[model samples]
Target: MTTEEKVARRKLSLLELAKDLQNVSKACKVMGYSRQQFYEIRRNYQTFGSEGLVDKLPGPRGPHPNRVSEEIETAILEHSLAFPTHGPVRVAQELALRGIQVSSTGVRGVWGRHDLLTRHERLLRLERAMREQKIELTEEQVRHLERFSPEFRERHIEVHHTGELVAVDTFFVGTLKGVGKVYLQSVIDCFSRYAWGRLYTSKLPITAVHVLNNDVLPFFEAHNAKVSTVLSDNGREFCGRKDQHPYELFLQLEEIEHRTTKVRRPQSNGFVERLHRTLLDEHFRIQGRTKWYEALEEMQQDLNDYLVTYNTKRPHQGRNMKGSTPYAVFKKGLPKATKKEPRKTAENTA
Candidate 1:
């Protein structure tokens, strides 16, 4: 029985034994209960009948009033509606800054009670929007998309400091000097966010493989490492040629693992794809030149500088409250590279 039940039973037995004893001190000694407890039990028995011996009435129902109230909950829901991408912990902090105290759990409870879509749901919605543009998605396809989602944190995509996972993709910068338009080959380390890229006149498989094998691989090896895996979207350059794409052949010869995201589902390769957009906006697009090839080498140098700044200086929002840089994290987990000066060349003139 519970402690309260045991106490009640002892109190009841003492009362019965007290009836047979005229001396109060003697009865208290025999029952092993203090005189004050005897008096209290007698008073309770006379006042509320037998039910008074049970535990006190259950406390107020539902969540405590000291916790988030209905008004505060409504405010949180409204705030979430305004900024659907914000997470509960971030919202809680924002509310605290406004002199409104609320726990992350409280905010989550409110959201859960309202059946609101979470941050992952928001990303999934956007992914769905992109998927709709290509073709109708089947249930199995939808499940696979969800499984590979960037927001799904359960599945660990193994990547180490600088060379574990490199995502490569081709993007069009703009019309290049002496060339109508040029395609760019870009590779970024998933861990440190260090990017190595080159511009080419065509999107041919041979050219893509040359960039990966001759330029990219050599650079990585010179830095004293080899990529453990290469992730890419379903692009013609990566998928073997009519017989064997150079990328596939290189992977087989080097014994490097290769993975590709589903066709038309960019979210599977979201990290590098997002980096691509950032580079275009910050470097190429803002250059205001229709033809980029005339200054391709300069652009490449600038891109490398940008990558260094991105890894060593710029703070990542996804990291903790300390605003840590990707390079800081990379250094903590991996061996340091020997410093080397950047090469000076005519094409590299900014």
Candidate 2:
């Protein structure tokens, strides 16, 4: 059956053979055992029943004697729970500074015993600990969780309809030969992913305001919709004194709320980030290699053409898009109570 069972059967057979032959020396020779081994087997079987016949590894048993004390083990676990991203060497060094002398190998051994040898395992332990206890997380711990946890990343701005919330950002399109550097002022509706962008030589507040005033708001107006909130990062172009900053003043004048994302957390404004990626992959990279542009107008014209196709022609497979164009989703997403007859296009207007 099992290795232990096989060994027990062999031992029992040796005893039985010794009885049947009535000769201990002959039985020992036949069973490949010394006379001393035969007596030891018989003594074990007689004393402890069958379990004593099973093989047991010879060791001191339980935790190794040289393992760090419980106090040091608790400190190592607490430090790991606080900063799950730290490696064993760093953990050991930190403990050393605190007068808790523990080698990296010792730290690793403790982690192994506790099933927390990997960074992910430590993070999971921290998350479970937070769920089970009423511990207030520090800012560093919050940032660490957000950095590595996909569930944290998935928590994003909620928008119900088109024009409810919009995201704006500045992107550095490569430098021109004559012009020093080209920057793109990009904006996108958070709900439908309808994007608008304009290239400029600088990323100033005026440039940010100009894109909203000229392209973004006009498109919303044409669709009989109004943007309620504008989300941007804590960049100079978007955030400053409410009375002095051009972007702030523009939002105030238009009666739209200006919301800035958490500092250094770009995923909060993921709509604009995804838009920039699409522009880079589908438009800029392809256009840069195909044509040599001398002026900003040429690049702008090409960008406009691509945008038109992106809004009205390209089938978007984003969340809830259902293979519809961005413009179609933008139109359909408007609340029925707020829906009005959209302004005529150039074809209809003409």
Candidate 3:
């Protein structure tokens, strides 16, 4: 028998001996227990019978305290379903705001029991599927891909004019409204991290080119920035030739030099891709809206506010030693010839 069971049997024997001997001290000596302990066991056996000797009775009891109640668990399930991308930590904070005292670990345990850990896993599966569909390259083909990658170039350490190098990419927002998907076409100035984005219904090359022409180019022109080289991934939308493909006409019109990253290597365009993830985590997922496209106007407005804050107000790590925004960095690097003087100065002098 286990030690606990053996101890329980001995305690029962001691209780019987105490009753039979009619002397607590005599029973205590025989049982190797103190007089106080003998009397306690005798009281327990008298009050609760044989079961009392198996385990000590729970200490003086009142009503049982409730932990996370059923109502709170239901709320957690609802919140998680509505916002699948949010982790337990965020959910715990949200629950706290609703006056529920729950831990992130508690929420995670609940999620684990309910089979709700699918967001990241789904992304990994999708990435794996994409990789499987991709053709394996020979050493020569791999070398060719590397030659075309922007990472092949040594990043210029010197301060350069704005728009000398632009990073461009398309990233999908999480599945929206449980039906259609939304794509974000984004471009960031390599020097400033000043970014612009457009929401598209599709990730088609035609749609991408349209956003670049209509929205991105105008923003750059308005800021007096000109993109000399555009860096992007080898995704079919970005790298496919026009004559061989459906988007050939649109591609020819943009006329900018296009460079692709090594296939499946997102780190080559790490800055813009990192921004994509940050946008989803910090803004999209936290906002807790189920149907994102239905709130497209609001989403776009919030994104613009975020972009303006990122460019003009937020401190950028990519900014040089000056410790300024991307906008500030780009302004600081303006060519002296391009800098404009105040007009009407002589006329106003009189």
Q: Kindly list the per-residue Cα lDDT of model 3 for residues 1-350, writing each as its tens digit.
A: 98768988999888778779988788889879997887777777778877667665478754336445678788888777566677889999998999988898778767766666667743454455567886878999867765675665424333277777778888887555644677888887777677888776678786767766777666666665556677888777776654665434444444556767767767778778867877787667866465335555666787787778777987766536266887787676544445533322224645
Candidate 2 — worst ten consecutive residues by lDDT sum? 341-350
Clashing pairs in 2: none
What ranking emerges by TM-score with the best candidate at the front?
2, 1, 3
| Candidate of highest TM-score | 2
**Pairs clashing within candidate 1:** 175-291, 176-291, 176-292, 240-245, 241-245
Cα lDDT tens digits for candidate 2, 151-182: 98669677899989999999999998997799
Which ranges of candidate 2 are over 4 A from the true structure? 1-150, 337-350
- 2 against 3, candidate with superior lDDT: 2
Candidate-wise lDDT, in order: 0.72, 0.90, 0.71
lDDT of 1 by residue, 206-282 (tens): 77677776676776666566677889877788886523677786676666788888777776676778778887777
Models ranked on lDDT: 2, 1, 3
Score candidate 1 by lDDT: 0.72
lDDT, model 3, position 4: 68
